[model samples]
Target: MTTTLAKDPAQAAARHAAPGQKRVTRRPNWVAGTASWIWLAIVIVPIYWIVITSFKAQSDYYAENPLAPPSNPTLANYQLVIESDFVRYFMNSVIVTVGAVVPAVAVSFMAAYAIVRSGRGRFLRYTNSMFLMGLAIPHQATIIPIYLIIIKLGLYDTPMALILPSIAFSIPLSVLVLSNFIRDVPKELFESMRLDGASELGTLWNLALPLTRPAVVTVTIYNALTIWNGFLLPLILTQSPEQRTLPLALWTFQGQYSVNVPAVLASVVLTTLPILVIYVVGRRQLLAGLTAGFGK
Candidate 1:
């Protein structure tokens, strides 16, 4: 009777899930919950402060209990922003970021594919190492040369000035991450496609790329964020209000006297909201892509 009862589905399941084979572990749950809350606070608290501050009046910004939610909230700052050329600045940022990231990601994908599947050779290793070397090279030291080149090419004070440099800078990093991801694709899959009479491009387009969607999306998100938030390249290269990005426009808040704190905060709020949206939308794919090369 006892043996029959133990063989029952629920009983068997309970036995199988005894402490050693438990389906859920308290340690992992506690660790994950603690880490999640810490990350949540780190991300949420700053944005909360910014949003709350954006609603406060200038006088209230300096109030004793500034951290407190505003007694009265208003949209005066947003009104000021709309009246100014903030929209134009936002558009410029969008154009620059898109122009830079699209080409960078596309080109890097091809480069990574070539590097990974091409073969083992001294040149290949050197080329791969050179990509890593790029990360070591500081942009600041090269800014002057970049500026001169842009000026010589008559691209200064234009959005292309920012787009070109941003793309150039992003390519190396993108290729590095993408190479690892492409290498993670099962070699047999590519071999099978070839055996079935698919060309190299067909194999890449139909076989490799479908599985690498997560990595590609993650790279795109990361590159977009980098380009969107870029400051130095734009600040030095572009000279006109028509060409300013959101980060540059925020500087307008600081005048010689009588800075508009709320207005500046409002611009910041506007600048960051799109990025926040992008990150929230792409976060799952980003994590998946980042971990794609790791074996489950």
Candidate 2:
């Protein structure tokens, strides 16, 4: 009986346990948790204020205690925007953003593929230097020239003016990001594809592109956000209310006679929601791509 008890696994485990070997409770520290909640509140308070303000009456918004909860929240501001040119502004923004990002991604993918697969030469190196120089050229300095070109081309006050210039500016960084990712793809895979009679395009489309999904997602998200939020380019490029994008249209809400603060805030909320959604969805891929590119 004694030998059997001593040989029991559970008994042995309990008997040989080290002092203070109690199971560790994984509960979070209360003070640390409270501090985190406070930090979160600090971050979210302004956003919450904006959202609440968007629902409040202008009089309530300007009350002595502006942070106080709205006595009456209404959708009048949203209704006003929806009844007016908001839809047109939304469509214009969509058109320009889509037009820019799609072509930029396609062109960047091809450029990256060629640079990674093809043998490096003086011409390619020079071309790449020119691409990087684009980052150095401030948009303000080139805006005047771009405006002149737009007028000469008769694209003034058109979405094309906005789309084309954005695509041009976005391509360099897109190409650079894609090149780093493509370069990281195993050379053995490319060689094997070639041995199996795969052409360069086939290899890129079938092998390279699929492997760089994270990078593609990253670049697309970055470009989409930048294009969506762009102000100066759209302001100078588009003049007609019909051609006005969201950012430009939002400015109309701030008139000299009466500023509809709630309406303006509502418009801001609407404009930002899509970008927020895109970032949340693609955040992991974006971080991976950025880290990989920088590390490489």
Question: 1-296, model 1: which lDDT tens digit per residue?
Answer: 35533367866777767576647544568888999999999998888888888898888788737568988898998888877887898999999999999999998888888888887867877888898999999989899999999999999999899999999899889999888888988899888998999988888789878888898999899999988988899889998889999887777644511466777778788888999999899989989887764786
Error of 2 at 149 (Å): 0.8
Model 2, residue 199: displacement in angstroms? 1.1
TM-score of each: 0.84, 0.84
Cα lDDT, model 2, residue 40 = 100
Error of 1 at 33 (Å): 8.1
Candidate 2: TM-score? 0.84
- RMSD (Cα, Å) for all candidates, in order, is 4.2, 4.6
Model 1 Cα shift for residue 173 (angstroms): 0.8
lDDT for every model?
Answer: 0.86, 0.85
Clashes of 2: 0
Off by over 4 Å in 1: 1-43, 121-126, 256-258, 293-295
